[model samples]
Target chain A: MTLSTMRFTEAHEWLRPDEEDPTVVTVGITSHAAEQLGDVVFVELPEPPATVAKDDEVAVIESVKAASEILAPVDGEVLEVNEALADNPGQASEDPMGEGWFFTMKIADPDALAALMTEAAYKAHIGE
Target chain B: MAADLDAARATPLTGMLAELGGKMVSYADHALPVQFAGVMAEHTHTRTAASLFDVSHMGQVTVRGPGAAEALEALIPANLIGLAEGRQRYGLLTNSAGGIEDDLMAARLGPDHFVLVVNGACRDADFALLKAGLPGLEVSMAEDRALIALQGPKAEAALSALWPEAAEMRFMDVREAVVDGISVLVARAGYTGEDGYEISVSAQDATRLAKLLLAQQDVLPAGLGARDSLRLEAGLPLMGNDMGPDVSPAQAGLGWGIPKIRRTGGARAGGFPGADAILAEFENGAARSRVGLRPVGRAPMRAGIVLFADQEGGTPVGEIQSGGFGPTVGGPIAMGRVDAARAQPGTTLYGEMRGKRLPVEVVPLPFTPAQYKR
Candidate 1:
């Protein structure tokens, strides 16, 4: 899916809502963040069914040159993790918005996604 | 060479590196590129092809005079008297307590002249020590020269294409070579555990020489980020990280650098600094030993991670000296100094990362196989 329909955080995390359930959102780091991270070698995603508060550390990405935390945007419980990254973490850089999605979470508030940044806003935020 | 890496703000190639899209970072006090193509990409490229690194920030000094080698031997614990011309030996300057003051490369340029390559941050102190330690010897720090390290499997092919004399040299051979009329000292040695050369050229010709090397089909530009990972994979310890004024040469796993000629009961024995304690450590063993560590998983167990014998941890048994993702080794690797009892390879230890104890095992050094020409 095109990133135009996705929501973004100032920290560069992007969330996409599943059509079947608006409250369930799949999240991944934006391409800008991936590009800035150089090469992603390791990823630590929260276990499914684990509840996290908004802005809590939900995942971690370790690159060859750096380490960074991925915070949860809106409180939620992790629904599923992309286990494929355990085998090939670089995929996060190749398809950051789609196949490289980090996790799917059952967001606490269905309307929280609307409050996040839009595609144009994200581009402006990153000064693209 | 540079004066103090933490005080030296720029190198001759700073502008060139920045113009090439290098991600410049304040390394120590110097502005150096952390990566160009990318740490992982540059690291991988250096494994198969060649990569040029700007190492001008390291200290370059020359101690020359009659009996200069003999005078230097009093401070550095290497067999410098027998260090024949055109040969290079790794040198470590020890302290009164046998702790390593600094690590260096000593090359006998001539019978009465010897050149040294030392760590940038420790240069000023090392030079001052040399001046005081080698009385009547001309100890001079070369400021007009810039150093470049060219490395990889194809390094010979790339350099030999430019200077046919390159193929004739093997590892650890040091000599003067001329490239495009640029008179430079070419040492067939480098930090990376690959077949490589360290070229000492005048600052005025550094940019020009670098451009020529980069034009080679096999050579690409690499920065300090890749240098760290490559050296770590090679099992070479970085000073101030794996060693310091408080770590003995033996404790730093650099005891091998002390040759028999300089050891106790050999010619010129026990004349260098901390000879009593260092020789004792060499024979009896140090309290702690430097070792290679595998973190068992992908997450990098970086420096500052404490090590313990038990997961529950009564007290820390060791600490990581240097660590990062081993792009070639394909996982996280680190070097640490652990208690002598837990130094054996295959011994499992726990490294506390982010308040979590991760399973780590002592592994054989040089996580990736070394391809040194020797």
Candidate 2:
């Protein structure tokens, strides 16, 4: 799904459900969060096949200024991670919504996705 | 949270910085810009071009007396008495316990006069220490003055356009020059390991001078964030973060500041406060020493991370003193005190962070080579 149709959390994470598989969703940080974090130099993502609770920190993004954690938007089992970030973390800031996707997760509860804010709602929440 | 701007002191260039989209933060009771554009962007720009920095918050003091040089030498380890006119030296104010009080830049303006630029956070204590160390000496604070730094490879070219004499100055040379009819003391020195100049002018004329410099095409306005990263890449230690009262010069790898005149068998030996202990560290090496660390992976190491000898949970050796992402180095670099045995370059170590051990190697300082115009 396109970023315009994705959902976002208050902590600046965005999630987009797979087009064919409704149970799987892709996650990454918002562009606003990337801008605030400055240049991304390193990223540490959780391994696949792991279960994470909502609001659990599953990844670490290091910028030139400081390090910030990427928390889980909703409880889910991790399916795959963005291995490309291991070589070039700048993708998290350059294409945060597209190729910079952190991990794909199998949603534990489909109702949890409905609780996230819509794209337009997230924009207004960040005053953008 | 919103910053308490009302309680913070404003520098002469504060308005100008704010107008340029600088993110202001409260630093050492003064409102200073942490970054103008972005930390990495500003840092990369400074490495290739010239960047102007507002350093007005730093303390500028003048000591002019017949015995000013000799009196000041009693507190610091540098051989200030031998420093010729128009030259500047890096020095440290050491306490009686052989620990560093503050690191500063001392410029010999005249035979009996000298100017000192000290850290902003340690200004009050540094000033008081100078007074307490050298009583009855003419120690005057230049509170009305403002300091600005133009650093990078293009610094000389940009500054020479405004003041022709600035182009003739060499590294560590301090001279008085007239730029746009405003008299300023320009020093050919900087903390960014670049060929640059630090200009000291009156507070009223600071903004105008900064605007004139920024008018150049290659000159950009940088902030403390870039300054910190630049210095880190240059292997220079921060006063409070890397070295403090608990860390001695030898332990901090700053023994170069102690000249031969202050060591044993020299004309003047052990006159400074911590001379006895500091000189001993010179003869017999320090147990722990500051060394550069380059992590194996992309993960950036940060301050307070514990360091180990080999792998995860291997033997706890030391802790990271100052660590951050080095824009010029293209990765994370850090400086920390470790056991002297493991301070050699290429030695393997592990930095513990978030329950994971990141492999780090002991590397030589100045993650990026210095481009000083010597």
TM-score of chain B of each: 0.97, 0.98
Off by over 4 Å in 2: A1-4, B4-6, B312-314
Poorest 10 consecutive residues of model 2 chain B by lDDT?
B1-10
10 residues in a row with least lDDT, candidate 2 chain A: A1-10
B1-374 per-residue lDDT for model 2 (tens digits): 14566678898888889899998887777888889888888899999999999888899989888899899889988899999999999999999999999999999999999999999989999999998888877887888888999999999999999988888999999998889999999999998988899999998999999999999879999999899999999999999988899889999999888899988877889899888899999889999999999988878888899899867445789788888899888889999999998999999899999888889999999799999888
Report the number of the highest-DockQ candidate.
Answer: 2
lDDT of 1 by residue, A1-128 (tens): 56677899998999998888879989999999988888899998888879999999888899887789999988889989999998899888778877889999998888888999998999999998
RMSD (Å) of each candidate, 1 decimal:
2.5, 1.5
Q: Quote the positional error of residue B290 for candidate 2 in Å.
A: 1.0
Candidate 1 residue runs with Cα over 4 Å from true position: B1-8
Clashing pairs in 1: B6-B29
Clashing pairs for predicted structure model 2, backbone only: none
DockQ of all candidate complexes: 0.84, 0.85
Q: How many angstroms is residue B342 displaced in model 1 relative to the true structure, after the best TM-score fit?
A: 1.1
